[model samples]
Structures are given as C-alpha cells and as structure tokens.
Target chain A: MPDDTTPLGAPLTTPDGFVALYRREAELVLRFCTRRVLDAETGVDLCAETFAQAFRSRRSFRGATQAEARAWLLTIARRQVARYLKRGALDRRAREALGIVTPVLQEGEAEEIERLAGLAPLRAALAEELARLGGDQREALRLRVVEEQPYPEVARSLGVTEATARARVSRGLRTLAASLELRWEGERP
Target chain B: MRILDELEREIERVAHAAGEARPRRRWWRSGALLVLAPLLAGTVAVAATTGILSGEPVSSDPHAPRDPNAGIGVNAGPGKLLAVRAADPAGGPEWGLRLVKTSRGLGCLQVGRVVDGRLGRLGQDGAFGNDGKFHELGPEILETSSECQQPDGAGNVFFAMTSIGQPASADPASCAVRPRGEDKRPACPRGSLRDVFYGLLGPEAAAITYREGGKTVRQAVERPAGAYLVVRATDPDRRDVGWWSPSVTPSWVESIEFRDGTVCRPDERPRRHGRHECPLKGYVKPRLDIATRAELATPITVRVGTAREKPYPEMDRKSLERMEWQRRVTISFRARRAADARSFYKLTAEIPGRPPNCGVGLGSPIARDIAAGETVTETLWVAHRCSGTMTIRIGYEQQTAPSQMPFHGDGPPNAKVGTARVRIP
Candidate 1:
C-alpha cells in the first residue's frame, strides 16, 4: 500500500501525469466494470468511456492522495454506469466529441446482460451476505478479487501472512456460496 | 479472444486521445524563454538608441526597381553549358519561363546534377525571362559563368531552361522532370545516355537479364545477399526496359522446385498460371512458442484445420471484407505431463491481412492451464482476406512467473516451445 502522506510528485493535471495514472489504474477500473456489468465487452466499452471523461476533466482533479484520485475516477465511472443503464445505450455523440471511438457490442453480450438481469434480487442478497463476513475477510476478498491483486501483495497490504490471506478468501467464497445455495433452496420450496 | 484484444487496444486509444487533448505547458514555457528574451532585449536597445520609439511608417527609396528579380544575376557556375532545353516542352516558352522564374525566384539558365542518367540537384543563375527574350541555342553552345557548379567527382552536369511548374509528387523516384525530354537527347556534352536499373530481389537470384527495345543484356551475380542490385546500361538514350531475374522465381510462380530445397511456391495454389507475373501479395508467418523448460514439462501436439468458416453475426462484414474475408478455424491440441503439478501454456495466433480498424477486434493471446495428459480442442476466429496468400501461425509459451501489477509495459519474454502453420484459400 502507498503511504497516505506521500504526495503525487507530479500532478495529473498534465497529459504525461494523466498517462501515468491511466497506466497504474486502468486494469483496476476494468476489473471493477467487469464485476458490475457481468459482460466483458460492455465492461471494456465502459472502461474506455470512463477514462475518456476523466481525461477531458483531468484539470479539475484537485486530489492530493492516490486514494482520493481513485475515488474521483470511480465517481465518474459510477455516473457513466448510471447513464448507460438509464439510456440503455452509450452516448455516441459525447464519446465522439471527446475523441473516443465507441466499440460495437459483440454477439451474445446483450443476451448475457439480460440473463444477469434475472439475478438482480440474488445479487442484493449476495451483497448482504458479503457484509456479514468479518472485516478482515471481506477486505482480503475485495483486494484479491475486486482489485485483482495477487495473494502476496494483498497479504502484505492487509498486514497479514499469505496463508492468512488465502484462508480469508477461501472462507469468504465458501460463505457466499452457502448463502446463495440456501437462498435458491428456499425459493424452490 | 478477439474481444480482449479489442479491449486492450481501446484502452490505449482512449489514453492517447486524453493525452492529445491536454495543453502542453512545458514546450510553451521553454519557447517563451528562448524567443521572447532575445526579442525583448533587441527591441529595448533599438528603441533607446534610435529615439524612434514613437510609431512611424518607414519610407522606401523612389529610385529602387519595383521588380523583385531586377538585380538578380545569373550564376550557373564555371561549368560550360552542356545542353539546355525547356523542362516542359508542351508548356511552350512563356509557360516554361514563368515556371522557372517562380520556382528559382528569377528566370535564368538552371543547371542540374546528372546522376545515373537522371537530372536533379538544381542550381540557378542570372535573370533570363525578365529581359523578355527566350535564349535559344543551337548544337554545341559554350557557357562561361563562374557561378555554375557540377556535382562532386565525375558525375555528369546537365542544364535546362527554367520552367513554371513543379512535379505534383516531389519523390525523386516518381518525379518526371527528366533532362532533354524522354526522347533521350544527350544531357552531358559527351553523349552520356545510359539506362540505370535499381531494385531489390530475393537472395536466390543468380543472374538478371534486361530486355528492352529488341535488345537483350545479362549480368551475373557474384554474391546474392537479398540486397538491392543496380544494373546500368550505357545506351545513349533508353527509358523503357523489362527486368527479369532468371534464378529468382516470380512470387506468383506458385510452384517451382529448386535443387537446393528452397520452397518457391505458394502452398495453396501449386498449379496456378501466370507464373511469369509478379506476385500481388505476401504473408508473414506469426511467432508461436512455449518459453522455458520448466513450462515445457509436457509434450504438446497442435493440429489446426485448413478449412474456412464464415464470420459471426456480430462481427462487422465491411471490416472483414476489407481484409478480403474471415475464416473461423478449429485448433485441437493434446498435452501430457509426467508430474501431477499444474501447468499453464500461452497460445498466440496471428492472421496476416488487413489490420482491424479503430474499435474493431483483433484476437488476443490465450493462456490456459490443463491437467496432466489432458487434451483440449478449441476454435479460433481469424481474418482471412488478402490479394495474396493468407498465413496463420500459432505459437505457445509457458507462464513462468506470476503476472505483475499495472500490466502496461512489455510482458516478460516467453521462450517459444511449439509452432504450427496453416494456409487458407
């Protein structure tokens, strides 16, 4: 984990600074979108738009910490997702004005989204079950899965051993699976 | 796989666009320091010394000639006038003079460097058209100007009257501004008409033949390095010639056997005709490999089908058509490991054709791990269109270490383990 007090040597207001930020944060942003959208194609498009919007307004980014910068980017991504859900499609004109080349959806992507839509209620339940886990376990799982960090790095960041990190992830997955299974069985009855 | 590749490319594109949109402050700040400092100092000094700080219009001398070219003198160098003719014979004297005056900044006799039977390296001297007289010369006219210079060494020097227009494309190879017209009048005083042939050929060529105007000329190659060969013919004047490399088979030859075991034929079209014509297209075999010995714990056998399939519904037709076509290929492979340990292999497939447009998919490399002695069959979608042969090559590499974070820069080098090639129609 980066020291919270460490200042960003160069601000992201410049193009080169923004490029460095993109290189560091793009994969994390993509993984976040993938988990939310449940489809890789839509997730990739949203990631492009997210960065495009961030770049256009990069001068306005006044954050001093990496966490604040990340939070700022995620806020933009959340708005992008909301707009996408509300409009049922991406804003082509807005993307074009910002020089983003919009990608066409691949085959079966729409169908995948529709299929994942049916599990919306279960997703809410899963979120609740995730909150039920211990704070350490939840944090470990979030770093390893959502942020897509490696085990050793996640362990070091969370101030735990590799074995402890692995155990927390395993326990979290098992708990989520069990809760989902119980929910499905209850619905069947 | 294609979607992943497109996604990676999109990320790069968006990052680049964002960078381009931002204003570059460093360049402007540096430029201001370098330019403004000198200008500010000079302006302050001139204003203080001359006492002309108040704004006033500068007056011009009434006796000066209004024409920009009035005082320009002809300076064609010390070389004698070997030969001079209008650069554009069809444009007549008036158009030629106008072009020469405009291009050289003054109408005068222009000299050029005659290299390999071509005229270039133009230098001008004296005003010619300003006097409203077209300088005509018969055979053997002497030019005695000290300003006229020749190309370094033994290169021949040529001269031509100034013309008004320049060639549309200034690339020397395609430019048509030849000396003394295409009829081949002597550019140098000593009848230096020659034919120059220059081009690259395959390393296998043993000899080349020049066939032009009912005459045949041949040259032997001492060493073939697959480099450019320059064949010159000392004919007073000749521009058209047919070049043939007998030992070098045309790419369209499709099928030709050599005693040295070189495959000089397209694998797909063995019996195609027009073997004498040049091949319209070519292919580059992709690099496929498994990186290191530890990753190669198991022996793998890969088989790729030769048949072609239509593109999927969501795949853009116009995009595929630009590449010529799309071919869905099926790849099957079997791997067997001695130990029960898990192993991962990287598979890369590249179809040589038109590159995908912005936001279009180009397939990504696949990294999959299989159990010991397990066999997996997978289908790969590839773009399949080109005027020439389309080649598809696959390689496998093993992932030795855990993937790094940020994942932006070049990946760890992978050692190639196995490769397969498939050509499609």
Candidate 2:
C-alpha cells in the first residue's frame, strides 16, 4: 500500500495517488457541472469528461497543495461549461468511438439531481441577501463559506482580526438564513 | 440507488483509458484548426488580390476591388443643377460635371476629375494622405473655410468634395436658372431629416444643423402640407430643435390655436423630453373618473335548512354547512371616460407590506375597454392573511396598445386615482 503520509511535493503521477485525488474532488466537480447543465445524464457525461481530461493532464500538474489541485479541476470544469454554452452540447463522438457508455440514472437519483438543479436559484437568492450585508461582513462570509477559505486566511485577506472575521461570518450567515428563511438542522439560532 | 456508484465506475473506466492513451493535446484543438485554417487562408488571398497589400489605383473591372469609400451619393432633393466647378489649386481647367434630377424628387450629381499627384487622397478631417485611400470629410471641415462659396436662390445648396484643406469655389453664372413660373418640387420631406438630426444630437439635443447626407447643404425647401418639419428656433440665450407635423395631431396634444384665433388645429405632443411649447393658444385636457367598492368579505358559511328533517329525526342536526376555508376577497371597480383615449384599462391590485406570494389569488380581469360616458365594472379576488385596516391598492392603467398588459407606467395623473383600507377579517 502507498504511504499515507505522502510528501507535500509528491506529484499525483501514480494511479493510486490519482485515484485518491479523484475520490476527494470528483463529487464536487460533478455537482458543479450538474448545477450548470441541470440534467443528470449530461452532467454525468461532463463529469466523466472532466476527470478524463484531468487524468490525462495529471503528469503536467505542478500544484503542491490539495487546494491547488481542486482549483485546477474547477478551471477545467469551467472551460467545459464554456464549450457547452458555445456548442449547446458536448461532443460525445470520441467517447462513442472509444466504446464508452454513459451510466443510466436510477429512479432514486432523480430527486438528488433535482435538488442539485435547485442550487442555482437558491444561490442567486442568497447572493441577493448577501448584498444587503455590510461590505466587510459580506466579503468575510463569501471567502469563508463560498470560497471555502480557512478563517485565518480570510481574516488576513480582509485585513481584519481573526475574531472579527469569525464574527462577521457568523452574523452574515445568521442574517442570510433569516432573510432566506433557511434553517440548519444542527445549528443554534 | 446505485447510480452514483455506476457513474463513478464509468468515470474510472474513462480515466483509465485516458491514462493509457496519454493524448498530448485536447481533441477540440485539432478540430478548431481544421475549421479555421481554410477561412484564414481565404482572407489572406482576398487581401492579396485587392490592392490592399500594395498601394495602387484599383482595377477598372466591375469585379475589381471597389474603393470602400466610393459609392453613389445619397438622395438629396429633385432640383436642377445650377453650377459646377473643379476649384483645383494646381490651376487645371474644370473637368466634366453634370447634375441630373431623378424621378423620386432627388438631384444626383456626377463629376469626373483628373487624379493629380500633387493633390493626395483626401484623408478624414482635412488631414492629407495618411493613407492612399480617399476618405470622406466630416461637415465640420466646411464650416471652417471662408473661401468656399454658397449657391444662390431661395433653397439652393452646394455639394462638393475636394482635396484635403482646399476650398472649392462656386460660380453663379455656371448655374442654370429655372424658367419663370415653372412648377418646382417641394422640399425633401423632414421626417427622415428629423430622424437624422435626433441620431446626431441624441436625447439631450440643444441645437442641430439641418444637413443632408454628410454634405454641406443648408437649403430648406417647401414642405408639402401635412408633412413633418424639424425646426430650429434661435433666441439670444439658446437654440432648440423639435419636430412638428402640420397634418397629424400628436396623441398628447389636444389642440393648437393661433393668437388671432384664425387657425385652430388638433396637435399631438411629440413623445420626447425638451421644451416643446409651441407659439400657439390653449390646449384641451383629458377627463377621467374612477369609482370602486371599498369593502368586501369572503363567504364562510351557507344555510341549507334541514332538507325536510333527515329521515332519522333521532339526531338533532344543524341547518348550516361549514364550507372549506377561503382566503379570497372580491373587489369591484368602475372607470368612466378615462383621460387615456385607449381602448382598455389594465387593472391590478396589491396588498402593501406583504410578501409577493401572500397576495396571490385568481379572478382579476386583465383589461376592459370603457367607452366615453359609459361605465365598466371589473371584479378581482385577492388573498391576504393580515386582519384590520389592510391597505389595498387598485391600479387602473391605459396602455398604448391593448396587448401591453400589466401596464408598467403610472397611468394619467389623477385619472380616478385613490387608495382604500379594508378589513381582512
């Protein structure tokens, strides 16, 4: 088995390392495509294409962090979205030529796909609510939640104290929840 | 239930294939190259065939590269040419020049001049020979020169093109005089000219010069009756230009009367923002009235009265049947002789201080046309949850067209406008 404590500089050139990176990032990349395409079948195909391209370019990746790897995959996904917008459909002739078959979505998968499709409108509403917050609070919340940045880095970027950054993120989230009528199951009011 | 697992397996298969193939470049790159290469090659070939690559006079073949700058002059007006001159600074005699009047009431000028090496191609803004191509000059260039002479007669204007920075002289004798009492064509219609003026000055126009087809023509010919005229008024402080049509009345204008009460005509106000007050008398106003029911309620229960005492008589029964909970309230309103002369009134209602979904209900007729002195009543159902003095706003709108529903603009001011409070319980 490969060592669990791989060096930071180690590249994902081996099949095991590539698979590990894929398992960590594939669901997120798939969700990103599903939100844009709004169709489960096509989104799965796009997800497959994104991973295929990422694997082909794995030897060329120079990132030293998992965040960099995720960003690289997201960049590829965005380019795929641009191509889909321009052509109105992803070209699947190459996949067909390679004898690759897309997976059929089962009955229970429809609800998950529909929930993913609803994310776009929900995010739009959240953005409108976010715009009503103070500029610092909005920026802190965006960096911490939407961008998934660590609170310390968010604080450094916004030039605020770590506690202030946490406070802003907390207040911003509470306000957005109230305005959008959203409730987190495990969260206290 | 296992669709995600299936997708993961599929992705793994594709990724394994991709790893084995190890393609050096994206497939779409090659496809794009295959499509764009031919187009790029064709563009280069066309550029080389035209003298665009090497500066030379274009070939005379009809298919030969045509000068981008040269084209038939725009239609001005049907008028006899009075004069023609070359006005060359190199002391060369004038070349062949003739003006023909077209059947569509436009005067077309044709002139042929020798291409002299000293007079380089006329560049933009009177700048000489930046490029080999002859460029059209903007009208501002003509206004700066005092040597360029104007044509004579009541509505005669000169049109000419010369080398950059050179003024073309006009001779009155070279102009042919129209025979006395000959029927002359009326001036070019002002509708198209007014459109051009608006295009130049945009929405905030203070003043504009009436020029036709990028030429320095200042002639104002007679406009036929009922034709639109774009007039520029001058005062010591400022100048303004606006459109006026003698025959048609503007939709907003009620009427126009002269100070002497001699001429009274219905006029339509131009749809624009500017000083449009004309030198005329009083105007008429639009009349509108609206009436409505201020209070209403939802029917909660109906009495059916025992239905001949339910054959069993052992059980004491009530006479009333409780209906399902209803949230809708009926509202009726009438509009009379609305200021807007349009056919229909678009109606809408809203409950202030409530979420958009809270006011959702059915049965409001979208629009109804009420004739002059005739009243039209419309009922709409609205849903609201709040009780006690809920403010309900009813809007009556007159749109330019019947199809423009849910009118966006506020209807005529004071056209039966009022708000009322109603009990929701």
Candidate 3:
C-alpha cells in the first residue's frame, strides 16, 4: 500500500514533512480505527484523535501525492470513525489537545488489533451473538444502532452492518410492530 | 510513547511551534512597528480628518520587495503591484493585494500575505510583516506579520464582516479577535473567514469564471481563473452561501471573457473583470483549483466500489433533522457516453462535502453531452450534509475555445474535463 508512488517530496507542511506523514499513515490509521470500533482502547483512541486532528490540520494538507497523503490520513481516520460511532464515547478532544498519551495496550493487544485487522473473524462471529445479549441489550447494541450513516456509511451504503442494518431493521420493525401496535424507536435501547 | 510515537512527537512539536512562531512574529511586530509607525502617521492624518475615505487594500509580493517598509515605502502613498499572486491551494500563505494611491489622493487597498510558496518565507513579523510593507490595518494588530497582513483600510473593496470565524472588518476599520488561548505565540496566523478577492486583472482580462456558492447555489465557475487571487471556503454551516457579504454579490460570477471579444453577462459582478483592455500576447489561462483541491489525499477513480445505498427507515428522524436543517440527497444520474450531438457537455456531478458536510452535492445538468464514449443520465439533489466521505465528482467539461481566448495554455478546469471520484461511504 506504500507503492503507487508514495515518494512525496517534503513540504507536507514540514514538521519534518509531517514526520514522514506520521510514518506512512500510522499503522494504516491504527488498523483503520481498530477495525471500526471493535475496540483496542477504542482503537487507541481513534488513532490518537486521528493524529491529533492530523496535526491540527497540518496546514490543511493539500496533496501532490503519496496517494494524496494516504487519502489524507484515511480522511482523518474516517472522521475519527464517524466521531466515534456518533459519540458513544472516546473523542478525547483532539487527543487531549496534543498531549497524546493513550498507548499501554500490549499483551495480545486487542488480539493484535483484531489479528492485523481481519477483525478476528468479526470478533468471533459477534461473540455468540454478543453472549445472548444482556448487559443492557449489549450496551444497547453499542448505543442504539448508529443511524444517519456511519457504520462505514451504513456498511458501505447497505450491502450491510450497523449490525446487519440493525438486525434487519430490528426484524423488520418487529414484525410490523406486532401486527401494527406501532412504537418502533430504538428497538428497546 | 507510541500512540504513533506519541502522535509523531506531538506533531513535530506543534508543527515545530507553528513553524517557529512564524519567524518571531518579528520581535512582536517589530515593537508594533515602532508603535505603529507613529500610529500609521496618525491614522493617515486621522484618516484625512475623518470622511472615512473608502478602502481597497492591495500590495503584491514576489516574496515582497524585501520589506524595508514596502510599497511606496509604507504609505508615503504612490504605489504599484497589481501583478496578482493568489496561491494558497492550502500550501498556506500567498495572497497579494495592493491598490494604493493615498496620502489622501484616494484609491487605497493594500491586502497582504505572501510567503511565496513552500514558505521560503515572506511576511516575517506580524500584521503580514510590515517592516516589509502593505500595512494600514491601524493600531498594529498586536505587533504584526506572522503572515496574512490584513487591517489596511483606506476603504472600498467592501470590508466589515467580523462576526463568524474572524478576519474582515475594515472600512473605517478596527478589529481584534486574537483569542487563541491567550497567546501560545500568535501574532498573525489566526484565520477563519476567507472570501479574499485580490485584484488587478484588466489588461483586457481574457477569461475568468467565479461562483463559490451561488447560481441558486453552485452552478460551475469552479476555478476558471486569470483574474488574480480569488479565495473562498465558506460553509460555517451554509447560512445561505455562507456569508459572502456586500449584499451577496458574487452572483456566482458566471463569466467574463474580454481580450477584445467581450462577454461579461452570466449575471455580471467581477466588477466586469477589471474593465480596461488591449495588450494581447501569449495567453495561457485556465488553472482553476479552489474546491480546496477536492480535500486532498486523492485517488478514488470513478469506482462504484462502495457506498451502495438503501436502508435507513427514518434514520432517526433523519439524524435529528440533520442537527437542525439542511438535507437534500437525490442523486440519480442515468448513463450515456456519447455517440452524437457533436459531443457537447457540461456534465458536472459534484458532491464535494467534507467535515460532516457543509455545502455542495447537487450539480449535474449543464445539459449533459459527451463523445468518444458518452453517457449522460441526470437527477441531482445532493446535500446529505454529514457523515465523513462524500466526494462524488462526475465533472467532464471542455469549453475553452472562445477563439482560443488568446493563445491559452489550458489544463485543469477539472483537468481538461475528466475526473471521477466516488466516495460517499
């Protein structure tokens, strides 16, 4: 992924050319925001607030190439993973305004970042259906099925995931709201 | 350490302390330019005993005539530099302005900021390095030039806009927002509002097309320059073309063809591309980039690859009514790769939204036409304001032959007309 001409001649708003573009896209934006929030301390806190908001807009990186500075640092780690799945938590204000700490994850580090981002077989097939849900309906299915796009733009625009379109729109709006009693909101969030 | 090497050593220590406090905001604006060169010679004689003589700021920058108090030597009046520099395609600094003629004879306009690319450095101290000259913003902005030297109001290029991401108040001016955590080293380099027009284009100005948010909101003037420095990034949540002041006249600039062939009316208002005329030799226009160069980190290549669509049964009252208003998504565009109608085209498709979307996503329809593999199917409604990646870009234009607008050097009006980046995912 470093080949298609990542030669990039300096001037990336120099800080030693954005530390060589933070060493070629900081582990590909730390396993792409740790496999989109399957968590590794929230993928090292959204790869340190996406390289501290790409080093505070490193003079707004307009690229000449290095695959446009790795698609401008994975579009700022895909908008810091869509603002951490629409704020379930972990924004850490541009990585605590550049103090940037958050590492300490060694020992099998979130199964080596979900096994080098294969995402440990989708976290072991969603860990037996998230251990038959309970722990507040699995943190209310990661805080109510993040809609209005971002579960990778509703799983790359519906070809699935916001947990299979929130499990088939909560089983097709719970069988059309149990024969039309209505009330379909957050399906028991 | 190792949050990517402590976020690459805290971004090379805050971009090496904002690239070394922008060259010592020149010993703090060279002591407010010797306490404002005796307060801009007593505010140019209290702005000629107060009639508020209309301002129009402009002063050029080849890397600035080595700033020994520049341009007719800091308002001893008589001036020059309408050469026009305008570079910031986000490489930062390069915005030349200067229309000076003052000492009260009137016609002043000195806007500065010109590091002249790759920050080889210019505007060395604050208020855009006055010791080098273009100054006139009154009361030396906390000792000037770490670049972007504004304030210069002798009056007239329509200033007064300071209320929303700072920078713009001058026309009988006096402004200061300076608040970035009370000085962590900032003399200049504070920016937000950037409409920046930068003048000097009338030697029969042969080609210019404006339009940064308008023509009922973006119709395509998408960077067709030859008219100096035309900046604009707006969208502090699109308050109808995000505050383009002076009673919203950019009228999307539309067109301005000149070089003795005359063209001006797409709705007119580039003040008719500098109005004078006649010297035509070696014409090389068409470089148009400002759409913040499609938010950098390029390459997507017309691939449909992801962003599929369908499924969002009332996606949470449309994501809380898109945090209160602005949501229009309709993109349909059926295909056609030309076999007829003399390959005519204006095939625009623009989704250009970045940062949870601010504006752009609904352009297609310049009566689509294409040749040598043509296809055109259109619908266009696109505002889906938020959610990260959106870059649509169908753009395939070609029109540049207004009699070859005088020897035109062409290239990049969306690269001769072919760019396809689909990202919405």
Candidate 4:
C-alpha cells in the first residue's frame, strides 16, 4: 500500500487536491450522479461541487486506503444527489442552478447492434414480460441491470439479504426469458 | 440491450471527458498543501536515499513510511488558512459555509461577515459543487466563526489559525435561534403561537426552541426541523421563546397526529443558562429531504402482491379502473440530524377530493425518529378506484416553529396538511 501519510505534505490546498481528486474520480462520480439525476452538464457541475466539498473537508480523511477514499467520495456524491431531489428539481431556479439540463436521448450505433443481434428485441420482450412479474422481481432486475450494481451490493444497499436479491434477479430473468420466447414465436411467420 | 450499452458508453464518455477537462491544479491555495506535498516528497526521498548516483537500478522505496506525511515538512508557524468570502448581501438568507473534509484533524473554522444572518453546521455528508449549485448538508454548520478574516478573502471567508488566535464564539444559542417570535414559542409555549408569529416575522428580535426527547442519555439531541424550529432551554417565566420560521408559511403547530398511531411533538419551553438562554433539549432539528417518484420510478409498471407469475399484470388505465386494486408505493426520506420526535406525517395526492373509484386501501405509519445523515424508506398501499384525478395527501404536525404541511381548503377547522400528490393506478 502507498504511504497514506503522503497527503499530509501535499499542498493541503483546495485547488491542488481538487485537481488530483477530480482527475482520479470525477468520471465515476459524474457517471454515477448522471445516472441518479437528469443531465450531463449538471452532472459536471455536481462533480465540481463534490470535489469542492472534498477540498473543504480535507481534514476528515484518516489516511484510509484508496478504495476507501473512493467510497468516501462517492458517498458524498450520493448525498449531493439526494439534496438535489430535496430542493425539488421541478423548481426552475434549482433546475438551472444544479445544471440538471436533460440531454436529448440520441440513438447510436450500439443500439443498432443490439437490435440486429436480437438481444435488443429479446430484452424489450423480456422487459415487457418482466413487468408482468411481481415488484420484488422487477426491482431486482432494475437494480442489477439499470444500476449495474452487483446483486450482493444491490441487496445490501436496498436492505435485503443476498439470497433474496438473487431470488428477485432469478425470478425476474426467468419471466423475461419466457416472455421473450412467447413474443418471438407470436411474431414469427 | 443495445440502448443500454449505448447509454452506458455515453455516460462513461461524458464522465471521462469531464475528468480530463477538469482543472489540472487546485484552485484554492491553502487546500493544496494538505493534499499534494506528500506525493512529491515520497518520490524525491525515494530517489535521494536510494543513492542512484552511480546509475543504480531504481528500486521501490522500501523505507517509505506507511503515510506520506511521515517525512513531509510542516509550516514553521501557523499555516496559511484558506479564507472564504462571506456571501454578499448575505446570499439572501439562503447562504452558509460549505465544509468538505480533504485531510483529517482540520480544525473547525468560524463564519464571519456582517450579514446579520444565522450560522449552523450541516449535519450530514451532503454533496456540493455541481455547476455552482451545491448540496444541502443540513443546518449543523452554523457554529461560531473560529477566526475573523485573515486580512484576506476580504473577510468574506473565516480561517482557523493558532497564530491568529481562536475565532470568537458567537453564542450558538443566539446564532441558531430563528428571528421569528411566534414560531419559536412552541418549545417553551408560554405565549400564543399567534403572538410570536407577528412579533418575530418582522425585524424585531425573538427566539424559539423545538426539542424532542433524546434516544440516549449521553448523545445531545439536535433540534427537529430545518432552521424553522430549534430546541433551547430557558427560564419559564422569561419570554425567551422564539420559533424557527421559514419564508413560506408562519402557523405554529404543536404536534402531528397521523392516521396511524404516531405522534411527533416539539418542546414548548426554553431553558436558560445564566442569563443566556440555551437551546432546548430537542433543539437540533432534522433537515428534510424528498425523493420524487419519477426520480426513482420507472415508466414500466410491474405487478405487485400475489405469488403468481402476473402479480403486477399490465392493465390499461381503463382496466385498472375496472379492477379492485391494491396499489403499493414506496417513499423515502433522509434527515441531517435526529428529528424532534416521531413525525406523524401525511402524504397528499394532487387529485382533489376522494374520487368515486379511488380510495386508500391501506397506509403504514412512519413513526421512527430519523437521525441526522440517515436515509429511511417505507412503502404505502392504496386501492385503485375509478375516479377523476387520484392523489394522496401526506402531512405532519410538530411543536416546532410552524408546519411545512400544505393547507387543504378542506382540512379540519384548525388543521394544516402538507400534500404530496401520487399517481393512482
């Protein structure tokens, strides 16, 4: 492990540490915040605020591991996103202030590939079918797929046991597969 | 499948762009010292002690201390403390300091400026700095300015330097106290809420306290709401009570009685220490946070309840209206600190009146006192009914400065209900 004490002599300056920290984690933080909130520009701005806060409270770090640092910073990002919600995104000023500009959902080549590969069609059919499942099963799929978090992490974060998490994912996936098969057959000539 | 991949890639791309585009160096001068110096030293020291003078093979610095600061230099005297400019025009009462922890053991700094405003600490690890709009850290950052301006930042920013001397302690009791009189009276409800309302709303001086019983004996409890209601202890006879008032509404509420068996009550009296009135016991209030449905809700509807394959069968609006349905919805809330008491809050739907077809089949009680920086979520159930616009109303009552619940034109004679509209299937 790198010497944790190194930051002690690091300029202890806001801009310097901010630049370093941002370079290291801004992308992940931005992507995470973007997924949580609406727009990318706002995500950028939130990224700035997250670092600015990290800069201000530099004293809170206890020389933990790099992974721990990432978690700490990400945790802060989470709170900021939550605050955005509290202030009510529906309000015009807040929306503007937070840079919550919703970017147009443009179509791209990757989407075309999935469509051609049949995975896209399968997933859609699966999703539609998945909706036919219970809330727990659906939630399992959404958390695992959309959030892209591991089942264990998702379950822990959502306050459920790992087994329950697996069950939700299992049940959801099964329903999707069944639904996709049925839909595909119905569409076949 | 393709759309998800594309979305993920786009997200990653933008995130990467942002990471690359960020300023390569720290903006604030003081923050640089604590975060960067160590890394540089480790490299230099490793190079020097290795005696690579004779073109020796570079070896990992085995002696490098576990912590980089182990061999780093320290400022001869008090370090250069970063100063922030106080909000101009006082940021219009919506401004305060934003503290982020970059290094451990950073001393607490005081806020300074002649805004004639209040200061409190943000109780939670709130996020900040997205396009200048920062996250809410709750109201705990409102402590006294530890030091005045260091002849820099134009005194807008306060600093903490041993050389300069400790920042003067502004009585937290006074600083946290809301200027509104009627609102503050509830903790020590000696005067009528009406009297304090008019007296404090204006420029006149007043204070209030809103305190709840502590979960434990040792942990000092914070007041319950935002700046609206604070807890303070004061003499019963003295008219020291003042309510924490929000800019929006100014009606005093003592307790909230929900449909379930939950009640949230704020202290009604102020406690005093010597001549200065200290904040009441349950003075620390929890900052409110709301997560919108669309923020977390998905357009696709899923089946709920039942063990069958079609627990949440897709039903057109008409079909949903036709069926006898039990709709379940989940809502989550977080607080910066412990609340005054169990909030008997009500959730209101935007749809006016009970629609002929829509009705709340069941509702759960959220009576737990939320601690600061904690997130809590609960699910609520309602029956689907064929009706015009279907909505649910959620409100809470507490003896804080005043209530944030909405006033239904159809509330009880003396009831105030805050409404949060939800879509009914």
Which candidate wins on DockQ? Answer: 3
Ranking by DockQ: 3, 2, 1, 4
Candidate 4 wrong stretches, greater than 4 Å: A1-12, A37-45, A55-65, A84-189, B1-425
DockQ of each: 0.05, 0.06, 0.10, 0.01
How would you encode candidate 1's per-residue C-alpha lDDT over A141-182 as one tens digit per residue?
888867878889989999989999988987887787688678
**Tens-digit per-residue lDDT, A120-147, candidate 3:** 6555645655555544334434435533
TM-score of chain A of 2: 0.55
Candidate 2 lDDT over B1-425, as tens digits, reads: 25556545544544443332221222213355456446543432112222322122211222232222112112234222223223333332232233333222112333322232111122111111123233221111111111121111221212222211111111111111111112131222122111101001111112212333454332221211111122121111211111111111222222322324433222333221111223212211123233232211111121112122123232223211111122444443444433222223433333322122222211122333344444434433222232333343444443321111122232232233334455555
lDDT per residue (tens digit) for residues B208-278 in model 4: 22223532211111111111222122333432222222212122334322223333332332211101121
Check candidate 2 and list the clashing pairs.
Answer: B77-B106, B77-B107, B78-B105, B78-B106, B82-B175, B249-B268, B250-B267, B250-B268, B253-B269
**Which of the CAPRI classes, incorrect, acceptable, medium or high, describes model 2?**
incorrect
Best candidate per lDDT, number? 3
True contacts kept of 2: 0.16
lDDT, candidate 1, B1-425, per-residue tens: 34434544444544443333322122212344456445443432112332222111111223232333112222223322222222222221111110122111221222232222222321111111012112222111112221111111112111111111122111111122223222122122112222222222323434344444566544442222222222132332322211111111223222333224443334444222212322211211222243354554333343444455554443345433333233555655555432111123344444333224332222223323345456755565443432222232233433221111011112312444345555544
Clashes of each: 31, 9, 45, 134
Task: For candidate 3, write residues B1-425 as lDDT tens digits.
Answer: 23456446545544553341211123323454456455344432112332232221222322233222221123434344445565543434455544444221222344544432111122222334322222343211211111111111222221111112223221111222232222343332234444555432234455556555453221221121232456554344532221112111223345555666676554433221222222222233333222223332233234332333333333334333322223333333332333111112333344432223432323322322233332344343332333344444443333222111111112223322344544544
The whole-model lDDT of each prediction reads 0.40, 0.37, 0.41, 0.33
Q: Per-residue alpha-carbon lDDT of model 4 for A85-167, expressed as tens digits?
A: 43323222222222112222245633433333345445555556767888877777778866777768979876899988977
Q: Which CAPRI quality tier does the interface of model 1 achieve?
A: incorrect
Candidate 3 — what's its lDDT? 0.41
Worst 10 residues of 3 chain A by lDDT: A180-189
Off by over 4 Å in 3: A1-28, A33-53, A56-111, A114-116, A119-189, B1-43, B46-50, B53-166, B169-178, B184-194, B198-225, B228-425
